[model samples]
Target: MKGDPSPKTETHKITGLILAGGQSRRMGQDKAGLIYRSRSLLDRATDLLRHLPVGDIVVLGREDTKYGVRDTEPHLGPARAIRNWLRRQDKPMNLLVIPVDMPELGREQLYELLAHEKGAYFHDLYLPFYVRAAKASAVHASTERMRDLISAFDLTELPVPVHWRTALMNINTPDDLRALEERQLG
Candidate 1:
């Protein structure tokens, strides 16, 4: 979807959502804390999004701001984290959400993805191909005091460039880290 263009505007419209609250299991550590280059993966991901021309940048994490994270409350899965982050916003806006582990993502790739998104209705805007957000307060309303209903949206994948495929890689294992390091060195 990154290659698709919209007729409404040439610049594209969207917000940046950084998913950062995962309890890392496979990596034997918090995936966002993994160091890449000179900064932690969390710092790198947030910085990359900050450089984008999006409306707002929200960090969904579990109280870790030393890396410059704003920290969203009501930590849940990526789905819930995203919704809670969205609810806190002063205004409604489209989002470009991705996990913290995707450290190699480039600004031009993100902009290209935003250019192709379209909304189903006026208030219901479509996000990038990687993920989409919808107003689902009621869907998550039935689970105790928790907003568990606010989960992942219906995803529509976009085909990115072959070299950029690593940009979506979520480092989950030692091998994964090794592979990334090798790629960096090579």
Candidate 2:
């Protein structure tokens, strides 16, 4: 009974973890609140994960929130929040992490990462990733940089898709978000 996963959880193969606790210094506002095709970045990330094989979804940080864990450390980058969530898990489970600012990440793209031996990530962009829960401590100790943490593994590195590279871009600043909205219109 102690080791058994709940029926609901048992049916899920992967757990979706939305990392939304960033300070958004560059964006000049909550990046999660930014609009992307009418939906907020936070809503889009959660919705994309829901279309996957994930058994459950949790968000890290953000107040007045729903379906997530608070960052506890606030803007200490992703390591603090991820580590906090990792230590709370009763058992090792596969985790799919997606940053709230990556508005264009889709189910197909995430699936590509999960298809790897361990997991996969864009050659440079690494927030949206697939990692086993067991590596939480290792990842925490590894580095605060998302790319470094993920690259330490023998995971597949994806090449930038020339056509959709903009879609995968991170909206880190107000200008970045504005540029993307302009691209969408033009």
Clashes of each: 1, 1
- Candidate 1 pairs with clashing backbones: 140-149
Candidates in order: C-alpha RMSD to true structure: 6.0, 5.8
Off by over 4 Å in 1: 1-13, 66-76, 87-91, 119-156
lDDT of 2 by residue, 6-112 (tens): 24333276788898888898888888888889999999998888877788888888656778677767888886677766767778777778889988777667766
lDDT of 1 by residue, 1-186 (tens): 453435543223455667677777778898877898879887887788667655556566745464334445444455555555555656545566667776776666666655644422111112223333444342343332212322233333455556766765667787888999899899
Candidate 2, pairs of clashing residues: 59-68
User: TM-score for all predictions?
Assistant: 0.69, 0.85
Least accurate 10 contiguous residues by lDDT in model 1: 119-128
**104 Cα displacement, candidate 2 (Å):** 1.4
RMSD of 1: 6.0
